[model samples]
Target: MPELIAPEAHRHAAWLQAHREWGPGAHEDGFGLLHDDEVDSPDGFAAWVARLRSSSGPDRCTYRWIIEGEQVLGGIALRHSYSELVREAGHIGYGIRPSARRRGVATWALGRMLDEARAAGLARVLIVCAAENAASARTIECQGGVLEEIRATEFGPARRYWIDLDTR
Candidate 1:
């Protein structure tokens, strides 16, 4: 495997554009983002770039993963800290390009993110996925996530899971 890296968000624009994925009503590429499409539009893309450059406080780290050289395989984001909103939705969310799904990218990317979270002083973390998304659930489980509950949310039905980095 190539090195797991953190590229400046500005340096990720073309990769982001080329790797976007649309999954059902949700764009898989947009999985962890609050407003993914906005970042893909003209003015929106510019604004997104500016946000990335100036991101601070709990927003300091965002990474674009590359494989075998320059191929932008996928990415992972680390919130320095999570608010109530994130505790319920999961601290990290990721998407492999459609072409990269099922080849263990998410598992690897997520495991890496968990390590980062642990290094940042998190002893345990919550990771939620849509209830119907078996693949996501499996990935979480594979990483030692304990299923805590399955419930309805404003965002629809979701499964709440927690992983203890201390044990992993």
Candidate 2:
């Protein structure tokens, strides 16, 4: 079964394999947290995760791996607050390994991320997807996301959503 766990060094090899499978910039749609150059080294990957874990501000963030024990299926990053730039970037961002897509991992990981948001005292979280990302839009909807607006950004048009966690 898939589960979300805090990022750790033991899963570096699995992350590397996943990144290689997706090639370059494939997962950047939602997962802009880990860059290829940064995670190419074990030490760098560790430092990257550490930096992500220690991040602060309106865009303060934390990330976790979607795993089944030793295998890393994907990841989710939750930003606690939003800066002007983050307003366009969204709050919860996620991605699944290429092999892991279309198997409910994104939905499952997103649900787990919502729980994290609730624990963090967030009443609601914003999620945005490229207008063309039907897969991501569906995943966001599955988690109770409501359409807020379609906004133009530097990247292109994005659909913004707000998911209320107060019910939980």
Task: Estimate every model's Cα lDDT from 0 to 1.
Answer: 0.68, 0.80
Worst 10 residues of 2 by lDDT: 28-37
Query: Which regions of candidate 2 are displaced past 4 Å?
Result: 26-37
On a 0 to 100 scale, what is the lDDT of residue 46 in model 1? Answer: 58
Off-target runs (Cα >4 Å) in candidate 1 are 9-13, 16-20, 23-47, 58-68
TM-score of each prediction = 0.77, 0.89
Candidate 1 — which pairs collide?
none
Best by lDDT: 2
lDDT of 2 by residue, 1-168 (tens): 987877777678987887788787645433445445388788988887777567776567877878886777887888887666558878888888788899998998898889988999999889989899899999999999999999898889999999989974
Residue 58: error of model 2 in Å? Answer: 4.4
RMSD of 2: 2.0
Clashing pairs in 2: none
